[model samples]
Target: MYVINKSRHSAYLLHAHIVFVTKYRRNVLGDLHLDAFKTSAAEVCAEFDAELRECDGESDHVHLLIEYNPKVQLTKLVNSLKAVTSRRLRNQFTDLRAAYDKPVLWSRSYFVGSCGGAPLEVVAQYVRNQRG
Candidate 1:
């Protein structure tokens, strides 16, 4: 999963483990909404030239292991994902909108950790193994 991406001047393999929590700790995320969310999130990743390596979630939060090139801005990618996914989910899923009195889907804070330390493929395998 750690295929190297080459630009005109460089080749790189960068991965980020990101977690997004729902606003107000509400149990708004469920099996009913996961597919749409995952699809929308994958499109968002594609928009930034990133790959959605893996995804999993609970009732209120979601975990994503993403692989992207160095050219992409991590903060911009994260923000767009939060905003676009939040807006799309709320618009598509009535239950999620009803779960929140406010219009926000995701909370203001998020978690992102850089992946390194052994090798890129090894880290990818470790993350893939984590799904179970």
Candidate 2:
């Protein structure tokens, strides 16, 4: 079972499945390439007191199943993850920027879905299967 660190004031537990696309929706992340980025994203999530259960994606977008403390603002967590991963991926893989034809690595918008009451295993499986 997945656990989230909760305090007295915050009883809510959040399991989020988030997705962000590459700039202009370019297909830059192949299998091997995305594995490295997923590894880095997991590290970033862990630093923020979140657990990255699964990280996967196609060429254009990334999908993450994350469990975080309710006290932490959701928007803040998403912003931090996106910013850190984008910067790191851009630096490590210059080809990503070039393929997308932009100085940035990811697009501005993202998709975040909330899971509550459902089994974590079920949610995680759904997130792993997301495409496009």
Candidate 3:
């Protein structure tokens, strides 16, 4: 079930699922890296007044489910998440830093999908049935 959240002026429910792949799709992440990433990601989300609801990953990629206010600019949040995580992870993990001569962690691209609330088709049908 989705819960409605509120700010001083509005109430809303918004969520997004995001996926970030390692640069070159490298399988460099281990348990420690994944843990650190969760921590780092949660902090970043909090900075944007969002919540990181869920996070998990494999060696090459990670998934994040974030609940955010409608006012948040997702692209900016994503860029910050990628940049901050890259810098933090590289500095903390020597092997990760050494794994690449170039200073890079995640790829330049990412996947993001809006989620939660009613399905699009369901909402569309409801709208079509409206008397007005």
The best candidate by lDDT is 3
Question: How big is the positional error of residue 42 in model 3, measured in Å on the Cα after superposition?
Answer: 0.4
**Per-residue lDDT for 16-114 in model 3, tens only?**
999999999999999999999999999999999999999999999999999999889999999999999999999999999988889999999999999
User: In every candidate, how many clashes are there?
Assistant: 0, 0, 0
What overall lDDT goes with each candidate model?
0.88, 0.80, 0.96
Of 2 and 3, which scores higher on TM-score?
A: 3
Q: Compared with the true structure, what per-residue lDDT tens digits does model 1 show for residues 1-132?
A: 355778899988788999999888788788867777789889999999899988889999998888988888999999999999899988998888888778998989999998844777887899999968
Candidate with top TM-score is: 3
Error of 2 at 7 (Å): 3.6
Q: For residue 83, what is the lDDT in candidate 3?
A: 96
Model 2 C-alpha lDDT versus the unseen true structure = 0.80
Model 2 per-residue lDDT tens digits across residues 1-132: 755455876665678889988877878888876887788888888878888888898988999988887566778888888888877877887777677555677889999998756788987888999983
